[model samples]
Target: MRPGATRVGIIDYGMGNLYSVAKAVEHLGASAVVSDRAEVLAGTDRIIFPGVGAFGDCMAALEARELTDFVRVAAQTRPFLGICLGMQLLMESSEEHGAHAGLGLLPGRVLAFPPGAMRDRDGRPLKVPHMGWNELHQLVAHPLFAGIPQDAHFYFVHSFYVEPANPELLAAFADYGFPFCAAVAVDNLFALQCHPEKSGEAGLRLLGNFLAWDGGGGPACGI
Candidate 1:
């Protein structure tokens, strides 16, 4: 991949919103290709894992495509980004379906929000899906969020969130019933629990930022 041109591989393991993510990447001036083939990723500068389904189903799809190993290896060296369910899979495991193991790229577990933590300020159930725009407070700075405003609102639609074993990996957070990790980063790995594609301008800015990030300039982790 060229230094200024970003060719992002949108890993298609049959579990993500690859089309929407591809559009987002393209809107950001990057070439997005959807595939699970390692050859497709050979010359790519960035890898995007965009998921929109169950943990077990996603894992099964990746395993069937023989892309799990490739994903692990890529995250180790290249700039990696995961969205929504894809973000959850970056953790060590998930309790969503009987202790299913995750990629373990980050030290954490993907878990559902506690009942007490599912209500709004007025004590109303905030809904399991949590689908809408919410402000993401910058917990730690990363080049991916370079020009994003503080407390920028992003679209979200999920019942579970990642609980990082190491707090230092949390990059951004949001408050619903309480504060929770909405985005995380450890080295070149980044995962966002929200949907940047549907987030309008600020979200587009994020995608652009990711394309431009070299991963060597973010603030120290766990700030």
Candidate 2:
């Protein structure tokens, strides 16, 4: 928990690519411990909630492990980060398969891309699952944006996106059919729809920023 010696706990509920995230954290000189033990996570300076797979399944895993409430409370105080499905799980609920409940830490819903991929102006498929790299337009100034170029491309792979009821939670966005909350930050919470671990330089810069962020530096809700 000490400055410049932060210990990060990558929550492993048996779904996420823990090694990749842990490697990314370790590469940045921060100690990374990938575990599911609540006591271990409580001792870390920050927590990275990363996941993949279905919304219901992820919530089930968290609940099964009894880590859901801990995560909700953690996001309210410490520097907590959620990635992809991890981010979507923060919403109140999702329509992935018959209105499944979520962590409800953030005010939003996870909705699937409309039908199939919408056609671009040039008549090409925009592609669902939003697979591959895309540009992110910075919506507001935040510590996460430090040294990151505006509109920097990041790797993404998902069929759904988050819609924060309070738009102020949006830190950056990208337009597939329309703009969606690509990243969100409020108080001590930071979540992103894209995979910073796969985003190359821009993503690494973001990870580095998150590692150094003091939680007080990010723009608060309602600014």
What are the lDDT scores of the predictions, listed in order? 0.84, 0.87
Residue pairs whose backbone atoms clash in candidate 1: 168-222
What local lDDT score does residue 140 receive in model 1, on the 0 to 100 scale? 75
Error of 1 at 204 (Å): 0.6
Listed in order, each prediction's TM-score against the native is: 0.94, 0.95
- Model 2 lDDT tens row, 1-223: 2356789989999999798899899888899988888888999899899999988988899999889878987888788899999999999989997799898888889998886556666767887778998899998888888999999999999998998999888899987877778999887788899999989999999999999988877768731
Q: What is the lDDT of residue 123 in candidate 2?
A: 69
Per-prediction RMSD in angstroms?
Answer: 2.4, 2.1
The CA lDDT at 82 in model 2 is: 93
**In TM-score terms, which candidate is top?**
2
**Clash number for each model:** 1, 0
Model 1 C-alpha lDDT per residue in residues 32-123, reported as the tens digit of each score: 88888888876788888899999888988888988888888887677788899989987889999688998877889988888877878787
